[model samples]
Every structure is written in structure tokens, then in C-alpha cells.
Target: MFAGKRILLIIGGGIAAYKALDLIRRLTERGAAVTPVLTRAGAEFVTPLSVAALAGEKVFTELFDLTAEAEMGHIELSRSADLVVVAPATADLMAKMATGQADDLASTLLMATDKRVLIAPAMNVRMWQHPACRRNAATLAADGILQVGPNEGGMACGEYGPGRLAEPLEIVDAIAAALGNGPLRGRRIVVTSGPTHEPIDPVRYIANRSSGAQGAAIGAALAALGAEVIFVTGPAEVPPPAGVEVVAVDTAAEMRAAVHEALPADAAIFAAAVADWRMKTARAEKIKKTPDGLPDLALEENPDILAEVAAGPDRPGLVVGFAAETENVVENATAKRARKGCDWILANDVSPATGIMGGRDNAVTLITDEGAEAWERMGKDAVARRLAERVARALGPVGAA
Candidate 1:
């Protein structure tokens, strides 16, 4: 997908800097031309020779290299690439970037670059959580810089939190999504994912078996198609997709508010498995086991998000909903489409016997006003891609901005 693309890869100082070598290979294997830039501190973790060897290009290391400057000035070099990627972006490096420092070659290129900049931050757990680091990250994000992952895990510093670099394949996918120019370019879409937790008490809640894999896949696919996606997700087992805006919510009420706030979108996809009911009067403390029999908890229906959004004043041009049924899938989903007033309904059999719930593969029937279109069993990502294509086709060509 990245054929003929040019990538300016900057390696920053960190233990995760070693992953940049594999990232270079991944990018090159996909037909991208990689120009490697190794920071002074980054060289301590991974040698410039290794980076140059993997990228099949000379590594730029010095800011004052007479030959390099004579050949291609910093400004020219920065503006020449299609995209700039900073792997293992250290805390110091990120702070420098946030402050617009240009003391070194890597920071200089990042500051001078005209193309989009994507960073994979890597730092100690405490460093990642520090107020200063968080502020810098927020500043960078506000400046429109793209970020992939500092996924949560045990760090090399014997601490565990969100400071690990994203895997090579994940970075490759983010790169592809950033470079893609698909049919959905210039469009904005909203996707809700995961199972909403309805609190029964301070310690317990009601949720479904949804892993949020399908919804995350759909968001990623739409982003790969060049759409700006707003991903409103609950407590999902799967992480949210890169290259999208993520709004994290816990309960069905919170999800509903988040969805409504992400309005004026080109399309909206309600893929969350919201709880049907919540305790009308949840106790402030955890319900204790008493001599009394089971507590009579009064249950009330949660907000019907799909119906409310479909019937809202600022409804998107296209609104899609999901129906995960154990029986009469098609019939029930068809009825759901009419009742919810959505543009399309994706019906799937999620019976435990089918293993579709919390599984990677899916067999879905796309129910539209036209008719029911049953798709064969496929990976969730493939289904997401196909659905994204359908959405693009339905929205037609990009109109005047």
C-alpha cells in the first residue's frame, strides 16, 4: 500500500530504539524508501550502521555535517519526505519537540518538516505519567502531530505502565493509514465500541462479552481509507485504533453523551454492546451479603443510543447499528433497523456455540433498506474493510468542502 512512498525515520534514544531497525525493514518491504536519521543519544542504543544497513541508505547523524549540508540542507531534507516518523521518541526528545527546540539534527528536522509527523513514545512508566510529560504530549497532540502507541506493559526500567513502543507491525499499519488516499478521504466518521458498564454498586457492574475487536477494526479500516474517525470506546479489551480521536467512557449514559458530542460527522457507527438496564437506585457502597434474601434491585432501561441518535436533529448522513443475536438474527436485525431508523444494520449470530463473541472472525448480514446481504465468514478486519467501502460508496464522492 506504500509503494513509491518516502519516509523520514528518526530514531530516538531509548531501549525501544532497537525496534526501529525492524520498523525500517517493515517499511522497506512494503515498497517505501526509508531515509534514516539517528540521534546522538539514539546511537547508544542502536548503532547508526545497523539503521543504515537495514534502511539501505546512509544514516544522517550530524547537524553540522559539511557534506550533508552541502548536498541537502536541513530545510530541504525535512520537506523532501512524504512523512516523518520518530520511533522510540524519548521523554527528552518529546519535550524538545514540544518546546520547538532545534539544537540537534533530529529535532531540527522535526521542527522544519512540512510533512506529517508521527511519533511512538518510549519512556519509563513514571516519566510517561509525569505532569510535565503529559502536558508536553497534550501540546504536541494539539499541534496536530500523530502518535501511535506507548502501549501499557512492563518497561525496561523494571516499572510497568504505558511507555513501551508500539510493535513494528503496528507502526507499519499506522504508516500505511497515514499515507493512504482512499475513497473516504476528507470525511469524518464516528464509531462507538466495547461493552458499556452499568454500575449496580460501587464495586460491581453489568457488561457484555464484547471485546471491542470488531469496532476497533472498523475504526482502523475507516482511518486507513483516509477518514477522520472519532472513536468513542468503553472499557475495551482491545486498544483503540491509531490515527483517530478517542473518547473513553465507562457507562451507557457516558457513551450516549460522548456519541452526541461527536456530531456533525459524515457517518456514525454504533457498534457498542450497551447494557439494557441499570439499577434505578444504586447503593453508594458495595451491596453486602445480609441475612435477608436477595436484594430487590429496581432496574430501569438505559438510554437507547442508536434510536436517539437516529432520531436526533443533527443526525449524520449515514448511521449504522449492530445487532448481535443468538437466534432469528436476520429477522430481529431487520426489525431493529426499522425500529432504530438507522441507514444500515449489521446482524451477526454471536451465540456461544458459534464462538463469535470475543472471537476474531465474524459472519455478518448487512441489512439495508434495499435488502439483506449475507457475507461469508471472514476476519473482523476484512468485514470492517468491506463495510467501510460500502459506507464510502453510499456517501458518494467528496463534495465541495
Candidate 2:
């Protein structure tokens, strides 16, 4: 897919640096030209000769080299690539990038670069969770940098948590998504996921059994097709997918606000199971059991994000909604499609018997203006792929736009 792409790969220091070798091979196999840059600490783990041999390009390691600097090599090197990638992005490297510190060649190149940067962070769990590191990560994200993974597994330090470098193939896929050379390349999409919480007090709230597996799958599928996806999610059981901008929210009101902020997109997918009601006057303190009687709780309706977005002035070209009905799935979904003013509705039976909620597989009926089409039960990932294909067709070709 990356036939003519040029990637500037920065190998950062970590045991995960070894994976950069495989990442280079994978990118090259997909016809991407890889230019490797090794950091001072990165050299501690991998030799320049190995990186240079695999990439078939000269390894850039210094900022003050006479031969290269005479021609302003750093400036050229920074802007020439289609994408800049940092694999095994150590905490130190991330901290530098976050703070705009250009002390070394890698940091300087990153600061000088005009192209998009993708980082695959690999650090010890404690370091990754430190307050400073967390703040830096948020800063980098706000700066529009893309990220792949720091998957959870046994670490080199004999400790275990979310600090492993993403697998090479996963990085390649993220590169492709970041490159956005696929069918939905120019399209922008918004997706909402998970069940929203409605606070009743400081210690209690209302929620649902949505695991967010399907929504996460859908976001991944859309991104794989090259759409720029803004993922607004509640406290989902599953982590948001890589290669998409994630907006985390907890309550329905917050989810609604986040969705509005992400609007004016090519399409919007309402996959969130938002709460219908919230406490009209939530108690400041936890409600305690009284010997006299049970406490009365007043409820009020929450914002209907899907309907409002569908009817809004800045509505997307295509609006899709999800209906988790316990009975008469198709009939109710068809009604919901019209009621919500959405172009399509994916309806599924989520009764206790179906095991659809919080489950890996799903069976949905696609309700459109034309009619209802029942899809066979399949894995959530499969459902997402099929739905994404339909979305692409409905939006028409990028060239047509």
C-alpha cells in the first residue's frame, strides 16, 4: 500500500530497539523506502551497520558532521520524508519531544520536521505511569502526533504491564493508516463508543453492559480504510484503537459535548449506549440507607446525541446510528432511523439471551431508507469491516468528492 512512501525511522534506546530492525524490513517489503536514524542511546542496543544494511540507506547519527551539515542535511532530512517514525520511543525521548528539546540529532530532527510523526513508546510501567510522563504524552498527543502501541506484556526488566513495543506488523498497519493512501483517504469520520455513566451521587451511578468491542472494531476498520477518525468514547472496557484521535469522556453530557466538538466530518457513527436519564439533583454525598424509608430519586432525560447531530446544521454527509433493541429489532430500528433522521441504523438484539452486549460477536440488521437487511451472526471485527465497506460505497469515491 505504501508503494512510493518515504519513511524516516528513528530508532530510540530500549530493549525494544531490536524490533525496529523487523519494522524496517516490514516497511520495505511494502515498498516503502526506509531512512534510519539512530540515537546515542539507541546505538547501545543496535549497531548502525545492521540498520543501514536493512534500510539500504546511510544511517544518520550525528548533528555536527562536517560533510552532511555543510549541505544543511538536518533540514533536508527532516522535511524530505512522507512520515517520521520513532520506534521504541523511550521516556527520555518522549519527554524531549514533548518539551521541544532539540539537544541531539533525533530530537533536533523531530523539532525541525514538517511532516507527521508517529511514535511507538516502549518504557517501564512505572515510568510510563509517572505523572510527568503522562503529562508529556498528553502534550504530544495534543500536538497532533500519531501513536501505535505500548502493549502490555512481560518487560525486559522482569516486570509486566503496558510497556512492550507494538509488533512490527502492527506498526506497519499504523504507518499505512497515518499515510492514509487508501479508499477513504480524504474522508473524516466521528465514532462514539461505550456506555455513558449517569451519576447519582459521589459514589453511585447508572451504567450499562456495553464493552465497546464493536465500536472499537468499527473505528479500527474505518481507520484501516484510511479515514481520519475521531473516536469519542466513554469509560469503555476495551482501549481505543491506534491511529485515531481519542476523546475520553464519562457521562452522557460529556460524550454529547465531545461529539459536537468533533463534528463537520464526512460521516458520524453513533455506537455509544448513552444513558437515557440522570439524577435531576444528584446528592453531593453518598445516599445512605435510612431506617425510616427509602430515598426518592428524581430523573431527567439526557441529551440525545445521535438525533441532535443528525438534525444539526453542521450534520455530516452520512449519519449512522445503532439501536440495541430487546424485541422487534428490525421494526424498531427502522423507526429509529426515521426518528433520529440518520441515513442508516445498525440494529441488534441485546436481550439477555442474545449475549450481544459485552460480547465479541454480533448479529445486526442494517436498516436504511431503502429497507432492512439482516446480516448473519459474525465476529464484531467482521461486522465492522462490512459496515465500513458500506459506508465507503455510500460516501462514493474520493475522486468524486
Candidate 3:
């Protein structure tokens, strides 16, 4: 996907800078021509020679190099690439970028660049969690800068949290997504993900074991296919994907509302495991335990979002729903596809024995008007990619099949 692409890689000063070398190598090996730009602080960690060696190109390190500036001004340097990437995007560098400061070469290029930018932030847990950092990150995101991760793990400072740089391959995938020109280009899609929380009281709520991994993956896959995705997600274990609009919600009602608001889409994927029921009348305060033992709680059925959307007046051309079952997965899902009035249904066994409820991998069967197609057990990401490809094939030009 990255063949003939030009990537301007800006390495920031951080313990994670070492990972940028591997990123350069990965980008180059994938047929991308990488232009390495090393920050002064970045040089303290990895030598320019190392970055250049991996990229197989000369490393640009200065804003005012007479010879290089004479050949290509900063504007040209910034505009030369198809995309700009900031690996090991330190808090300081992010702050600079957020504030539009161009005190150095890397920031200058980032400021001047018109191409899409992707950042992989790496910082201490505290710094990453700080209000200022969060604000800047939000600002950057709002400005359309794509971000990969500061995944949770032990940091160099011996602290553990979401301050670790994303794995090199993960960043590579993100880059490919950003540069890809897939069949769904210019299409708009909506995807609902995660387990919605139905409040039973002020503090307590009802939820499922869904980790939201599959939904997040599906959103990412769709984005990789060049679709503009609106991801309506409940509380998810996995972070939302880059390069998509994320709408966070807590209850099934909210998810439904958000999905409707995001509609007029080309397709809709209802992957969220919304609670079947909610408290009829949730108490304002926590329900205290009494000598009378457990209290009788009235339950009410939550809105069937998939059915509603599938049968809505503004329904998309394609509507896909998921049927998670403990038994007779295919049979149940086949029935669900018909019952819900959806075009397709993805059925999966989420029994405890399958370990797929909150697991990394999925074994799913695609149910449609024609028949059921059982897919082999694969990672959530693979399932998402396959589903996305199927969506593309289904919604593409008349002769696409």
C-alpha cells in the first residue's frame, strides 16, 4: 500500500526515540521512501547516522543548513512528502506543535507542512495524564492530526500506564491506512462499538463483557479503505482508532442517538453489545443494602438499535448487525438477520469456553441472504479487515463483483 510513498519522519527526543529507527526500517522495507528529520533532543538518544542508515537517506537536522536550504527551502522540504509522521512525539514537542511554535527544524516542517500528519506520542505517565497535555492532544486531534498510541505498559521511568509508544508495526499499519487508496474512498460509514453501560443507580450500571476490540478494529479497517468513519463507541477497553470521528457514550440509548445523528451514511455496522435491558427507574442515589436482602429491581427493554436503524426511514444502503450467541451461533444469527431486517449479520460464539467475549481473537460466521460463510478463527483486526473488504465489494460499482 505504501509503494512509491514519501514519508517525512520526524523523530522527537524521548526514551522512545530508539523505536523510531525500527520504524524507519519498517517504512523503507514496505516500499516507502523515508526522509528522516532528527530533533536536537532526538539526537541525544539515537545518532543521525543510525536513522539515516535505516532509512537509507541523509538525515535532515537543521533549519538553517546553508547548502540544503539553498537547494530546498523549508517550505519545499515540508511540502515534499505525502505524509508527515512524528514518532516518539514527546510532550514538549506536542506542546510546541499544538501552540504552532517553529523554534526548530522539526517543528518548522510540521508547521509548514500541508500534508496529513500522524503522531505516536511517548511520555511519562504523569505527563501524558496531565491536563495541559490532554488539552494539547485534544487540540491536535481536533486539527485532524492522526495519532496511534501511548499504549499502557511499564515506562523507562519505571512507572506504568499509557505512556509507551505504539509498537513499530502498529505505527506502520497506521501509516498504511493514512496513505491507502482503497475501494471505499470518499464513502461515509457509521460503526457502533463496545458494551454500553445502563445505569441502575447513581453509581452502579449494567454492562457486557465486550472489550470493543472488534468494533475498534472494524472502524480502523474502514478508515484504511479511505472511508470517513463515525465511530459511536461505549466504554471500550481498547482505544478508538486513528483518523475517524469518535462519539463516546455510556448507555444503549445514547449509542442509538449517536448512530442516528451520524447517519445518511453509505453503510452502518452495529457491532456494539448493547445491554438488552435497563433499570425501569434508576435511583438518584446508590441503593443501600438492607436487612430485607436484595431489593426487587424492575427491568425494561432497551431500544433495539440495530432493528430500529435497519428499518429506519433514512437507512443506509447496507446495514450489518452482530449476533453474539452462546449456542447455535449460525442458526441464531441467520434468524437475527431476517428478524432485524438487516442486510447481513455477523454471528459469533461468545460462550466462556470460546474465550472470545473479551479475547484478542474472534471466530465469526457471516450470515446473509445467500447463506452463511464461516470464517476461521483470527485476530479481531483480521476479521475487521475482511469485513471491510466485503463491505467494499458489496457497495462498490455495479461491476465490482
Candidate 4:
């Protein structure tokens, strides 16, 4: 998809700079001509020779090169590329870009570039969440600059949070989307998948039959269509798809918090089968069989994630929820759509005989305010694609006024 595309890649200093080499390979493998720019700090992590070798392009590191400047020059070099990308965009680089500082070659190129710029921020957790960094990020967004991710995970510093750089494939997908290569290129969608486990104890939990295949498929489909997908998922049989931001959680409350954190999205699809209740107070130790009958367990309700998101002030333009019903599928789903205040509900029969609960195929009825549209049984991937197409149609053109 990136054939004949020219990407000026700026590698900033950080432990994550090593990932830039792999990123270059990923882009080049897709037929993109990558021009490597190495920052002074960036050079400390990965040698310019290695970067240039992987990119198959001359590494640009100096602002004042009499020979090179006399030829292509900084201005021409910066403006020649179709797009400018900053990978492992360290806090220093981000601050420079945000404030328009051009003391060095990397910052100069960013300042001089006329093309759209995308950044994959990488920093210490504290630095990423600092007020200054947050302000700078907002400024960059407001300036029409694009961003892929500072995905949450463990970092090299033995800390965990939202500071790790996105995976190379994820960055590639974001680059494609930024280049307007897909229909949903400019949109951001949130997807909740898997069955939330409500713990009765540390070792035992209550969950449903959801495998998370449908939600994974949906996230993959949305990303393939160029949408930025924030995948909030629980422990499930299926792993999340590539090219999406994955937020893994265990309980309903964690999932709810993750979903809210991923909000202000263009659309939200709730496919997770969250447990309705959890033990009000779980035992610190295991309950063993004794002369005394059985241990008494108190339960409390879990937050209704779909209903809350649908009725909340930060509701997305399109809200979709799933209803796994064993009887009156359409009728129950239609009522669920109304009761949950969601825009649409996909109802499916998970009866043991149907084998749809943990099976490969699904027969679903889509319930909207207009009416119910029953779809024939099909593979989960096919259903996801169809739903994604409908979503694209309903949302209209990207960035539409």
C-alpha cells in the first residue's frame, strides 16, 4: 500500500530507539522509500551505520554539511518527502516540536517540513504524564500534527504505564492511515472485547463463554479500513489483532475504566460479555469444606459499561452493544437497545445446540431504532467486515462537516 511513498523518518534518543531499526524494515518491506534522520541522542542508542544500512539511505545527522547542503540542502530534503515521521519521539524532541525549537538538524527538519508529520512518543512514564508533556501533546494535536501511540506497558526503566512506543506494525498501520490509504483513515473507534472475569477469590473467578473472536475480528476490520482502534479487552481465548492499541484488563471495573480512558472516540462497540456481579467481599483465604454446610458469599453488581457509556456525557457518535440471548433474540435485543440507550445492538443466540457461544460461525440480528435486520450465519470475520462497512456508511465521510 505504501509503494512509491517517501517517508522521512526521524529517530529520536531513547531506549526504544532500537525499535526504529525494525520499523524501518517493516516500512521498506512494504515498498516505502525511507530516509533516515538520526538525532545526537539517537546516535547513542543505535549507530547511524546500522540505521542507514536498514533504511538503505544516507543517514542525515548534521545541520551544516557544506557538500550535502550545497546539493539537496536541508530545505529541499525536508520538503521532498511525502510524509515526516518521528519514531521513539523522545520527550525532548516532542517539546522541541511543540515549541518550534530548531537548534539542531532533527528539529530543523521538523520545523522545515511542509508535509504532515506523525509522531510515536516514547518516554519515561512520569515524563509522559507530566503536565508539560501533556500540554505539549495537546499543542501538537491542535497544530494538525498526527500521533500514533505511547501505548501503555512495562518500560526499560522497570516501570509500567503509557510511555512505551507502539509496535512496528502498529506504527506502519498508523502511517498508512495518516497517508489517507483507507476509508476510516481519520476516525478513532473504541472496541471492548472478551468476557470479564469477576473474582470470587484470587484463584477462582466467574466468566461467560465469550471467546473474544468477534471483538478481535471487529478491531482488525476497523484498523484495515484505516480507523484508529483502541481495543479494551479482558482475558480471552483469542489474542488482540495487530495495529490496534490494546488495553488488557481482568475485571469489569478495570474494563470500565479502560473504556472511559479510551473515550471521546468517533464510535464505540461493546462486544464483551461482562459478569453482572462480583463477590462483595472476597475471602482472603480459600474456603474449605467443613462440618459447617457451605460458605456464605455476598455479591454486588458490576458497573454496566455499555449503559454508562451510552448515557454518559462523553458518549461517542455511534454506540454499538452486543446481546447474547438464548431466546427471543430479536425481541430481547431490540429491548436491550432501547434500555441501554445504545444506537445499535447485535443479538445472537448462544444456545448450547447452536454452538455460537464459542463457535466459529454466528447468526445475528442487528437491532436499530429503524427495526431488526437478521443476518445469516457466517464466520466471525465476515460479520465484522459487514459491521465495519455499515459503520463507515453510517458515519458518512471522514472529517465531514
TM-score of each: 0.67, 0.69, 0.75, 0.59
Candidates by lDDT, descending order: 2, 3, 4, 1
Q: How many Å off is the CA of 241 in candidate 3?
A: 2.7
How far residue 27's Cα lies from its native spot in candidate 4, in Å, is 18
Which structure is stronger by TM-score: 1 or 4?
1
Best by TM-score: 3
**What is candidate 4's TM-score against the reference?**
0.59
Candidate 2 lDDT tens digits, 292-329: 89899999999999999999998999999999999988
Clashes of 2: 0
Residue range 15-114, candidate 4, lDDT tens digits:
9999999999999999999999999999999999999999999999999988988875788879999999999899999999999999988999999999
Candidate 1 TM-score, C-alpha based: 0.67
Q: Which residue pairs come into collision in candidate 1?
A: none
Ranking by TM-score: 3, 2, 1, 4
For each of the candidates, the C-alpha root-mean-square deviation to the true structure, in angstroms, is 6.5, 5.6, 4.8, 10.7
Per-residue lDDT for 1-401 in model 1, tens only?
Answer: 67889999999998999999999999899899999999989999999889988999989988998877896678877998999999989999999999999999999999999899988888998998898998898888788888776665667778865688877876776676677655687898999999999888999998888999889888877876678999999999976776789999999999999998989899999999999999898889989888998987899999999999899998999999999999999999999999999999999999999899998689999999899999999777668878988998888658844
TM-score of 2: 0.69
